[model samples]
Target: MRLKDKVIIVTGSTTGIGKAIAKAAISEGAKVLVHGLEEDLGLQAIQELGEENTVLHIEDISAAGCPEKLVELAIKTWGKIDAIVNNAAWVVNSDIGTTGKAFLGKVLEVNSIAPFLLIKSALPYLSVSKGVVLNIGSVNAWSGEPNLLAYSISKGALMTMTRNLGDVLPRTHSVRVNQINPGWVLTERERQHKKQDGLSENWYEEIPAMYAPSGRILWPSEIAAAAVYWLADESGPISGQVVDLEQHPLMGRNAPKDPSTIHGKP
Candidate 1:
């Protein structure tokens, strides 16, 4: 019960890593505002997390004033806010040639701007409670693959927002902010994304060892476990930190050479 009596808001929590974080917070004795765009998924989360301890908020976060509305609903349900996990994001495949102005605007609106708005909307409550904000970022922030140009840019903006707010909020309001840049998580959405990219149903099984370090990609639950540590007071008053959650070193690591190519056998 590390988070006993705390109230948390987790955006985009209807599925995947966001859903895992909501569940983990509740298990640690926190009441949560579970948010998502899908009503059905929101209902599923309410059923799983229990109505007594959870509030389901359905909204397109990129819409105007939705962030403030979400914070208001959390306060109405729980009387205060202890933390907010800005986990909702919109990702679409687009390279320099394919990324249009409309698409780029949409991507930035959801993936970058929405989180900033959520934090701003929740700032008053967070200050009152001396709360924390955990932003779920991506390792792709560090120059994503060419195909992920717009998405990479959006994440990079988010990473900057995290650090900027992390430094300012803690000093000015006693509210902490931190971010986690997760790598290659194996969620249902990810599986579907791979499928859309022409990967077969057995794609996970076919991932080369070079990609999946532990014979598998990262899991939402594993990310959730790390999140709880930051959300809880056990992490102290630390802020302005970005953790890259990946098996391989994010910096100064040589690309994995193909075994067959190196051995000249195949």
Candidate 2:
């Protein structure tokens, strides 16, 4: 019951990591606003998380007035907002040639700008309640795969914003902000995405040692578990921090140098 009676808003909660976080928050005695664009999936989330502890919000994060509406819904439903998990994002692939200004703009709008707006709209209430904001980022923010150029740029911007606000908000507004960057999580959508990319259905079972030091990547629930600490008061005044939730160190780590261990490309 670390988050007892807290009211949280988790965008993209209809599926994947966002849904897992909503489920975890409710289990800890919190009421949550589960948001997603898919009406059917939002209904499913509402059903699974229970109507008593959760409310569903269906909208495109990039659309105008969406952030304010989300804040309005949360406040109107529970009369208060304790935390906001900015987990909604556009995860798409595009290299240099494919990533034009519009592509980059759209990615930034959904992944970074929308989160900023949500925080701004909820800041007044959050400051009054001494609430927290958790941003779900990605390990790819530290430069990224060639195909994820625009997404990486957007996440990098978000990481910067989180660090900037993490310091600014806590002191000026009395609200804390922090971010978690998860690496290679095994979500349902990820399984389907990989299969579409020509990987076998059981590709996760045979990950390369370099990619999965523990013979597996990570799970949505595991990331959700990490998110709770930031949302709870137990985190104290800690702010302006970005934690990497990967199996191993992402920087300056040399591979085994064994070509035999590397079988084929992903």
For this target, which candidate reaches the highest lDDT against the unseen true structure?
Answer: 2
Segments of candidate 2 deviating more than 4 angstroms: 259-266
Model 1 residue-pair collision total: 0
Candidate 1 CA-lDDT value: 0.91
* Predictions in order: lDDT: 0.91, 0.93
Q: Candidate 1: where are CA atoms >4 Å away?
A: 259-266
Query: What are the per-model C-alpha RMSD values against the true structure?
Result: 2.1, 2.1
Taking all chains together, the TM-score of candidate 2 against the true structure is: 0.97
* Candidate 2 local lDDT, residue 64: 98
Please provide the root mean square deviation of candidate 2 (C-alpha atoms, Å).
2.1
lDDT tens digits, residue span 25-65, model 1: 99999999999999998999899999999998898999999
Candidate 1's displacement at residue 62, Å, is 0.6
Count of backbone clashes, every candidate in sequence: 0, 0
Candidate 2 per-residue C-alpha lDDT over 93-182 given as tens digits, one digit per residue, 9 for 90 to 100:
899999999889999999999999999999999988999999999999999999999999999999999999998998899999999999
Stretch of 10 with least lDDT, candidate 1 = 257-266
Give the Cα error of residue 262 in candidate 1, in Å.
14
**lDDT, candidate 1, at 227:** 97
